[model samples]
Target: MQALQSLADNYNYFITIFLMVSGLYIVIARGNMIKKLIGLAMFQSSVYLLYLSPGKIVGGTAPVLDPAFTVYSNPLPHVLMLTAIVVGVATLALGLALTVRIYEAYGTVNEDQIFARDNKK
Candidate 1:
């Protein structure tokens, strides 16, 4: 069927969408700080995939000055994705570090427990 073929052709887009939704759901549904960080990382990874997907050409080679190659994949998106990945890593590290500090201070990573403790104090 046409719809099936289209879905097959755009499977990567489906995967990206699935990851984005699942990551957002995890972030919103979980109470543990570490789980939320994991979800955030998943969300970031989906973004990387989204950025990199369109720059790919089926038969294109890397951007190089070669007369034999008529088509070359765009390198700009890949470069930007690399920078994004680096920033994402830094952000994940900082988030984890903060989670560690919070756990040390509060003795638990559950949001509700932390809020309850704060309310009691």
Candidate 2:
């Protein structure tokens, strides 16, 4: 009963792990460049969750100069995650632009076809 409760309390970590694994698997198994980009986005989302989960405290207050609050939540993780999100978005956009260029050059987004064409060249 105690173990179950502990697991339930920490379920967010498990979810983060699941997303990370699924994203990695999709990136590895999919041949489509768009699918790989989707997987990379998923992995980035999981990283956000991983940092935010531990920073949440049940009875914590904002880290202001308040003597009444003994427990204060750290804001650093949320701030860093915000920066990470912006960077992730920029990276995704760049990746999509590159994908478009790749398709224009190769006429297909599949890795196998691109490799075959390169071999032929």
Candidate 3:
């Protein structure tokens, strides 16, 4: 029961871990370039969750001159996450564009198929 309660208490970490493993598995298990990109995006999402999950407070307020609020939430992680999201999107887009070019050249997006075709030549 204590373990279960502890697990519930840190469910966010578990979720992040799950996404990370799932993403990694997808990336390794699949041969398609697009699927690998999707997995990379998932892994990036897990990292974002890892940073943002701890930085948020349920009822925390921003730092201000007023004396009423004692707890202030840090805004740095959220800002960083926004930037990371933009960069991740750009990376994904570039990866997809490259995949398109690879398909055009090799007539397939599967890495194994491309390698086989290369070996034939």
Candidate that scores best on TM-score: 1
TM-score on alpha carbons, each prediction: 0.96, 0.87, 0.92
lDDT of 1 at 52: 85
- Backbone clashes in each candidate structure, one number apiece? 0, 0, 0
Candidate 3 residue lDDT tens string, 28-106: 9999999999999999999999989888887888756578987877788988999999999999999999999999999
> For residues 1-116, could you state the per-residue lDDT of candidate 2 as single tens digits?
99899889889998999999999988999999999999999999999999998997889988787888899888999899999999999999999999999999999999999999
Q: Rate the local accuracy (lDDT) of all candidates.
A: 0.94, 0.94, 0.94
Q: After superposition, how far is residue 3 of candidate 1 from its true place, in Å?
A: 1.7
**C-alpha lDDT of candidate 2 relative to the true structure:** 0.94
Ranking by TM-score: 1, 3, 2
lDDT per residue (tens digit) for residues 1-121 in model 1? 9999999999999889999999999999999999999999999999988988899988999999799999999999999999999999999999999999999999999999999999999
Q: Which scores better on TM-score, 1 or 2?
A: 1
Question: Which residue pairs collide in model 2, if any?
Answer: none
> Native-vs-model 3 lDDT?
0.94
State the displacement of the C-alpha of residue 26, model 1, in Å, after optimal TM-score superposition. Answer: 0.4
